[model samples]
Target: MKRKVFLSTTFKSLLFLLFSFIYTLLPLQAQQLYQPAEQLGELFEQVQLQSVFPDSKTFPDATPLASPDEILQAYQQQKDQPGFDLRTFVMNNFEMPPQPAADFRSDTSLTVIQHIEQLWPVLTRQPGNDAGSLIPLPNAYVVPGGRFREIYYWDSFFTMLGLQASGETELIQNMVDNFTHLINTTGHIPNGNRTYYLSRSQPPFYALMLRVLAQQKGKEILTNYAPALKKEYDFWMEGANTLNAANPAHRRVVRLPDGSILNRYWDDKPEPRPESYLEDVHLAQESGRNPEELYRHIRAAAESGWDFSSRWFSDANSLGTIHTTDIIPVDLNALLFHTEMTLAQMAEMQGNKAEAKRYEQRAKERQKALLKYAWNEADDFFYDYDFVKGTTTNIPTLAAVFPLYFCMAKRKHASAVAQKIEADFLKPGGVVTTLNRTGQQWDSPNGWAPLQWMTIQALRNYKHTRLADTIARNWTRRNIEVYQATGKLVEKYNVEDLTLEAGGGEYPNQDGFGWTNGVLLKLLTLHPELLQTTEQEAVLQR
Candidate 1:
């Protein structure tokens, strides 16, 4: 009797062990089976909707989507909501489709499709109007909250291009109008159309903004916006020549000769940078420099958006010549030159030919100095020259391309530089902002919409149609692939893996992104014809 009872107890223990193993394996298998289907279903849902509200905290009282029916019901309810507040509803509930579960290692096509589909919603959203306002349409992508609550300065420029392509001209006009309004209401445009950017401004794009509006709306639009444009121009040139003067405490200060003024990528105070926390730390380590020096370097780099340490600065002797301090950037000067030229053109249009001629002469002089000082023949690229140290950084970066945009670089140099971009910067997805091994957000492995547009435009300007077509086709193909797969558009993509990574900025990459959508559409519409031999010949003649 005792032996039989002991055997029975052992049998029960074995049974219990077997059940536990099965329990663990069941969920893992179930997850594998369920997740992909769920994610695909989500993508289908997104394809059918116009916008979604992903920010729930902003609308805590709204109902949650318990099922597909609930999502549709919410839309109907939103349509009925008073005051045309579709934006509020969409911001509270939008979510991106899950990344495809296929092995990224074996299937490049699957990876490309996944990325494009993920970017779909971002591509479809209307262009103008505040991204976070009470507008009544669903944005095509998901944008994160916190520091991303407002529209960014430079980002808007690219976003506008996408809008133009999507046949959303009215929305683009609205976006331009908002910026003009901000300039009229405030002495300067905010860094973004948000409360956060109110403290400091980014690169002065007011002239560029006006130019874009004029291109879309007609030359006459400039007359109405001239006062606001002048005000913004003055804001950028403020204290430009006042290196020796005492200034208001709140005003940005920079040393002369170097032409360094407080520019973009800085805040009023020394709070940690929200987007580039890792890059900033690495820069400090590689430079073997102090925080104050690094801070100034950060500011200088902000002028060009190429914030990283490279082989150029690896040597201490060369690094010393690098103005990590109050430094001026060649691109900044080039941009200002364009601004001046635009002003001269505007003056000419308004019948102020005498003033136009004066401004034109000033632009030409600046251009001459820019080429003389910024171009490094040894490196075969234009670099940021530190006027104080009287040396140029030898790091080859995207800033080198801007000279071509402004006709600052001669034809020979532009051709050489364009070749460098094709060889080094071009990736499968698009031209990267910079090389990625540097670990900078703006560097390699990261492709941003604005830089892509800039590179395309610059290549066309220099008559490199073959190269331009290659870039435009690659970018558009990638964009469409992602859109078809995920049913949304995104702010940035991971060029290294050819997958979508969270975009960098003060916040998580916001989808329903105004600029990304706008620029993609623009590229789709204009890029195909941009590569004709006639276009290339025209550039050469110019």
Candidate 2:
């Protein structure tokens, strides 16, 4: 009996050793299943409690879930009037610019310009205030200071506008070349030149970038970048065509019910998301809320940007907001439609009829799906339809205007939405981001440069020239007014008050802004004719 016991003990020890060796040899991805300790620990406790007392009858009551149809009905009823008090919204949300000067003055005089030119190398320094992070090689320089602002995705789009207007065709081409080079090297474009954004991309602007470059340069440029464009497209559509499906994770492309595929924003690990944490803390401090609740609020905001959005927030979970889990988005799909159209055009030009036909068909199908699922006829706007909840947020925001820009919205529907904008969101200053009373930067009383430009362009596309012109002019006037008063361009503005207090973002109202300044120059130069288009005739006809 003593010998048998000894043998069993020795076998157990050997097994343990084998397991330890196997664990050590595991891949990094398998070994690093690191979830947030707090969240995971809570989940573990719940599992243990259920296992320990199988007969225990403890369940939380179900909260009522709002359907997209219900939200749309409610929004249709309430969207006509000003959704929130304009004055209070502006005052509560606005943040004044920091006191003291950063000295970014432009010198036009020959002597000063010459001196400034000599110092351009130092002045246009890339974001290297910290020695810890690697500085990216400089691309095109933002003039006046020659400072290297890595105009990421949106900044690049807006900067291209200025480059086009200022007759800097070479610079515009260089910007496109940089993006193409990055795509070829990395398989995807980073949000900026920052190492932090290397993991996830911003908007899929590769096709748009190519289209713009092609327009500016010619077919030769498009031909050169076609392979790069195709590679980036493959990156966005990664994991989408997999037959052996697995649980979705960051960077995985998922398909929606409508059969279109797109990627949603995600991070591999969960921490208190820096962007939402800052915004939520600011909001909680302003509203006098408990810090814990603010954390939850921030988590909710972060989850909203995730692939499985409904799973991220309690309020959103019931509506099958889960449909967005690895699902396509209206904006994303619309952008893809543009991509398909561009690709088809390129293929046709290249004498590839087979490829052109395939892309053209794909674009049409996506357009159909986007309109079918995302549009709410009753509300006269587009809201993200949660396929799971059969619900939509009836929130009239700038996202609604994207379809128009893509020429995806029907002429009649686009016209109706434009009228709704005039009746509701548009102010003397420009267009508000959304009608939500939350006072978020993406909410009302805050007007962003990109959204304003988008709205103006969308209206012009629909031949609503007059209203488009008015919006463009009003936005430019407000921008010029603020600049003349403060000698600075801001990231956003208090549209309601024409005040310097710009509100609602992770950072405290970023200035020395790149995109805002770029868009302003573009609108003023390329589309001045849009400002002169009259809406008086359309109103009279109505």
Clash counts for the predictions, in order = 47, 13
Model 2 global lDDT (CA atoms, 0 to 1) = 0.54
How far does residue 368 in candidate 1 sit from its true spot (Å)? Answer: 1.3
Cα lDDT of model 2 by residue, 1-542, tens digit: 01111223235334533443444364423422222222223322332233322211111100112332342344345435765432232123222212222545633232211322223232233323212111132245442211223446645676566555555555565566556555644456765443334455666666776666566656555655566667776776677666122433325454554455444444333333322233333445665645554444344333232211232222432221212332334566677678778788878879899999998997887788778777888887776655445455554567678789989999987988899888888887888876654434556677888778879888989998888877787777776556545555667788887754767533356554555666777776576543233223223535
- C-alpha lDDT of all candidate models, in order: 0.53, 0.54
Candidate 2 wrongly placed segments (more than 4 Å): 1-101, 106-138, 141-149, 243-252, 258-263, 272-328, 527-542
**Model 1 regions lying over 4 Å from their true place:** 1-147, 244-325, 496-510, 528-542
Give lDDT for model 1. 0.53
Q: Which lDDT value does model 2 have at 423?
A: 87
| TM-score versus the correct structure, for each prediction | 0.63, 0.66
